[model samples]
Target: MTVQDIRAFNRFYTNVIGALDHRRHLHAPYTLTEARVLYELAHSPRTDAADLRGELSLDSGYLSRILTRFEQDGLVERAPSAQDPRRRRITLTAQGRETAALLAERSDQAVGSLLSAVPAADRARLAEAMRTIREILSAGRPPRGEDIVLREPVAGDLGWIVQRNAALYAAEFGWNTDYEGLVARIVADFAEDHDPHLERVWIAELDGRPVGCVMCVRDEAPATARLRLLLVEPDARGLGAGDRLIGAVVDFARGVGYRDLVLWTNDVLAAARRLYQRHGFVLTAEKPHRSFGKHLTGQDWRLNLTDAQQ
Candidate 1:
């Protein structure tokens, strides 16, 4: 609680930010602060100027100057707010949105690069450390820990599962739509014909938003279950969601007379591999293959439920 400790942490985090932000031309077309404003405007359309100021905690005069610059550049347009004639509304033009999207892509690339240096085993600790900092320092109440719930997939979750898998892989690994096609096929097959007794999906919700999902289904081999498509968003990571989803799958498999649980994952997914290892899964086999535009080693991991019970 001492000021010195907080100042030291601030310096440490500043270095981390510099590493991520100092990548090639992060602030070329826009300053870091201006890029942040563009990001906010991109996500929240028809927003009041004053509200934007409050949301970013920017000085009103400083924000007005930036908006003026953006207007001069034809990046955004301002109008009187419909809710309050006295207030001003801000909207990003098509050009502005394009700029914002470019900035977002650059940001994602920079983050992906920074993360590549961190070993997979250390990523969960890093994510947890960052989440703790954000939770403790943010102005509002931190996201509710008790609000997390796991439920069966509903009408739209299948689509969500496919889309999120595709988007996450694309952003993090530069994977192509071929991966999306594979996930779509798996989901479509599940939808077409899956036994209720031997197949199930769990969607992890935080604050009522789906942030993670996994599916357990009967394997081709008798008395076996396959775990597939497990994913947790960055925000939901380090919050026990992945662990919860996998635990649910294991429990259900063991409950329904399954002798073994098996999963296939690429070696690049080291964090997930670690999680599977912690749950007593053994790496049975691996082989190199070209997949999703990368040369990767595909692995088969298995957990023996009968052994687990003993």
Candidate 2:
């Protein structure tokens, strides 16, 4: 549909639904948005939230708050996705399923009531019109903003970092619990005790949810800081999230008066290497080692703070 066509349809549909207001007509507890979520859960076999947000085109933070409320009310349970542990799976409880059924039945009745007034032949036309709209517009995800945000970790953000790091690496690189344990230690150390001024984490928020994260923490070497746990979700890549995260880490390291910023990564992470080089980090040394259930070349990259004028 053209822009004008969509606008016209939206206006007409709003008026139609406004008269048949679901809240009043359905006489149910769930809001429209809540009903929409329940409907998705009831219908779709896929359970992970990363795809859910994409399918629904809802704001990540807003969806998160909704899910949190659902959890509190025992309407939904969230766990790691079996297909990809990096993504979270959302499931409805028995009570939740009952509620979903009620919502579904009411929704069907509401639509049925609306359709009762129209001729049977026109109902076929209406169904076809809806299909045409979906066929045209449903293939795309929402357009992303040019702006990506970097902010401090929130209540669940730290644990998210560990889970993502562990699960993502294992899925992407065949790493094992050994790597997970390492990440657990790093996250534990960061959370248990740290100098807030000298050590910091940046959660890269895109579309109102975290898509990437990086951390700057005090290194064993004097006056040096380590850049650690740099990761961006696969779907969120190529949108400059990695660059932004690296930039944030560099800025934080420099701001804290660290003379040098350093990081270690495997040679296999060519894209990450490119980002590091783009940010003026130089490869100082590399060594091959067997770790994470694989033999890999570990590369140390460093940036001298004085030369980093930008």
Candidate 3:
């Protein structure tokens, strides 16, 4: 490789975030893989060992040994699966939960502080470059191949949406029961009496499997509509599901005579911000809210629908 290319990679990877990740966040007693396994367990109370095996692509023997160590340390528990006694499920103990949170919080703090130190314009450039790299890698791999078109949610789909929303938020951000319960209430309401004319739910499917979902609800606070329960599966995030979902919501809102749209999102959702901006959503306000065991700075975004997209 060219010297310039090597230097760029060194500056961005080794010299940049790598230092913080290694020095600040990587010093936990657990190995990185073990920490990731703990993270998976911390999110869902009980997850199948086979499921974890597939999710993390860990070898059966190796994973079992790691889990055994965790169990011995009172950090994790293994139980027989109800559906099949031969199968085992793994869960985090109280100590495991606390350890996972501490690790996650430290990682986030280090990354957040480092990113915050960069100038706004440079940060934007860095973000875009990271996204482009993801796109390039995705194009080369094409895990599921091509972009998936999202459709309105159908029967039984709401259940998957709730599961994905809860599991993803919990794993990614340490968001917990409160967030999941709020999503459940919204989904239950829509299932019981869904007004397609007034509200809509959309899901992105790959290989006929739902990977992402977004919903629009009629807002009572004002006459505007609120975009709620927006989520994309981590694997499918960089493939444009977010932008498509937001676009669909905004289009539906305009079609339904709503002149304004609003959404609440944590500041850590960088991709969501880019999508919102592309769809004419502007930051209107900010508030400090603490949920899921940590402080979060949330921003309110507003979109005026009078000037519709072409």
Candidate 4:
């Protein structure tokens, strides 16, 4: 798209979203920037003026004035950080939290009303287009390893896992739909009959979007666990997602008293194999197979948890 196209879209979106309207922000006394600051403080674990300035890209003097106004209005409290008394930490007071919550609810309602105007069939397309725009823009500056979070799967995560794995593998490795079918079956079985005590799935997210996944499941052999469906998106590589997912599985296996953890992967998956080896997994077996419309060597790698515990 041309610069004019982007600028026109931005202008249209700003008007549609009331981005220039300070008075429309929940009919509150605070401005839009103030509401954003309150929201960030409410959601963040650590908050400081420098970090806020960097995040919002605000002029330091302007941000200081806003913070001063917030403090005067009893919407914010600042204190010396316990970890570093030299630095001041900002937090929302009870009144501030209430105000922030109100702003959030109003904002959500406004967006909901806007979206409600669109046909239901087109909402998904709209959302996907927004995601595509974000992904394309963010391709230049990916998140760091520290920003990645590995969490348990929630509703709809299984379907995402299957879709992402299928699309990524097919595009990158020329794998066929059979690979996607395999992922679908594994996910379906896990969702249907997984044992809570011994089986677990982890989804790695960066900036709230899933970029990788892995699962630990009960193996057929006694006291053994199997690692399955370990995958990291191409855009998310080099951020240590694969290593983190493997580590989560290994730690879960050891915590649950499993004797060994095993995983089957193809030799062509060199990056995954490297991560497995670094995590103390030893190659045990390999064989050539024609699957996923390709001739590939399926290999099994095992890690002994008995030694890991010591």
Candidate 5:
């Protein structure tokens, strides 16, 4: 949609639901921008201002002004980062937290009240459509919302990947304890000694949120690499995340002079198989494997890394 079309829709929505007016009144004490800063600080306390600046995509002077006003109003506090003396970490004060909570409650009520008229089934469809629209709009777009970035996994991203993967596998494949243990071991090994030269992890990010990840390990043989632990969040399945992850691993292997790449996966992983095949990997071996709660066939795939891959 064009800008004009979006404006027209906004106008229709505001007039019909009185949303815009209600929001203005409810947030009279603080401008939307200031309130957003408060909300971000409330959720992610002690965030560095530089990080916020990048997340919100605000000019340094403009952000400083907002923060200055907030500080004068006794709504937030700023402290020097212990790790980085130059960075100022911002956090909400008690008053700021309370105000943010009230704002959130009011906002939720406002949205819920507006949506209540829609039937449950229709609401689900609406929600799905909205999610699809958001994904389309946000493709390749940096998240510039509320001075806080929702991010994907990065090279050093920790915590959320482990938790999200465990939950995701449990929901998707009925994968349980064994899968979790395997993931735990991989994470532990990476944490203990991540050799950037020999191996690396790649993550897909949305506004900084870690949504997908893959690890590539160099093999003992002179020009070989092993791909492992590839995963993409269910919410972030589309937008070619899996493809990008595999490409990153392949590119990394090639950069390090690997002449071939290999991976092992279960037969049930149809999407992954397609991605592997798209990247020039061919299934060279298959065998029935009784493990991880199911009797399934495992496929070992290998790619001849041509000059481009090398």
Candidate 6:
């Protein structure tokens, strides 16, 4: 697209979204930037003025003025950071949280109204176009490692795990639908039989999308746990996601009093094997198997957590 075309589209989007309206407010008269700042403070665990300025790309002077207004309005509270006395940590007051919630609700309603105006069949296309635009624009940007998060899986995530694993394995390793069926069954069993205290699954997310997953399940032996379905998306590789997932599983297994952790994988998955080895898992056995439409060498790896700690 040419510069003019992009500029024209930007102008149209700004108008459609009322971005130029400085007086727009969800529950009170506040600028869009103020609403955004409140939203950030409410959601973030801890943040400082410098961090906010960097994240929002705001001028230091402008951000200072906005924060001053917020403080004067009794919408925020600041305290000296424990790590650095000079830096002040910012947090939202009860009033500020209420305002932030209102803003979020109204923002959702606004977007919902806009989408409702579009034809039903075109809505999905529009959403995909937005994702395409974001991906293209962010192609060369350096990833922030801190933005990667490991969270408990919620509704629809199990299905996503199965679909992504199936698609990625098929494309990368020529795996067949049989492997997908196997993943489906594993996920189904986990959903139905998992115990919250002993078994857990974590979904790794980057930019609010599922990029990786790992699960710890009670193994056949009562004191052993099995790590299963470890996967990292192609784009998310080399970003330490695999290491983090494995670390999470190891920590969880140890915390729950598991003496040993084990996993099964095909010999062809060199990257995964390396990850396992790096995390103190030893290759214990291998067997030839004809499965998933291929002759594969099934390998078993084990980690003795008790011995490793000593």
Residue-wise C-alpha lDDT for candidate 4, range 109-226, written one tens digit per residue: 7777787889999988888898688768878576787667666666689999999999988988899999999999999999999886578788888866899999999999999999
Can you tell me which runs of candidate 1 are displaced by over 4 Å?
A: 1-139
Return the lDDT, model 2, position 202.
79
Worst 10 residues of 3 by lDDT: 143-152
TM-scores for candidates 1 onward, in order: 0.55, 0.55, 0.52, 0.57, 0.51, 0.59
RMSD of 2: 16.6
| Clashes per candidate, residues 3 or more apart or on different chains | 0, 0, 0, 0, 9, 0
Candidate 6 stretches greater than 4 Å from native: 1-140
Q: Lowest-lDDT window of 10 residues in candidate 1?
A: 139-148
| Candidate 6 vs. true structure, TM-score | 0.59
lDDT of each: 0.82, 0.79, 0.76, 0.82, 0.71, 0.80
Clash pairs for candidate 1: none
Number of clashing residue pairs, candidate 3: 0
Candidate 5: worst-modelled 10 consecutive residues by lDDT: 145-154
Using TM-score, give the best candidate's number.
6
Candidate 5 ranges with C-alpha deviation above 4 Å: 1-156, 307-310
Question: Listing every candidate in turn, what is its Cα RMSD in Å to the true structure after a full C-alpha superposition?
Answer: 18.8, 16.6, 18.4, 10.0, 14.3, 8.7
Residue by residue across 109-165, what tens digits does model 3's lDDT show? Answer: 888788788998897688778767666757665754234656555557999988888
Collision count of model 2 = 0
Q: Between candidates 4 and 6, which one is better according to TM-score?
A: 6
**lDDT (10s digit) by residue, model 6, range 1-310:** 7999999999999887774243344535777787777765654333678778877788989988888888888778777765577877676665665676677677766676667789999977887888678667888677655566676676799999999999999999899999999999999999998886678788888866889998899999869999999999988888888887887787667655799999999999999999999889999999999888889999999999887441
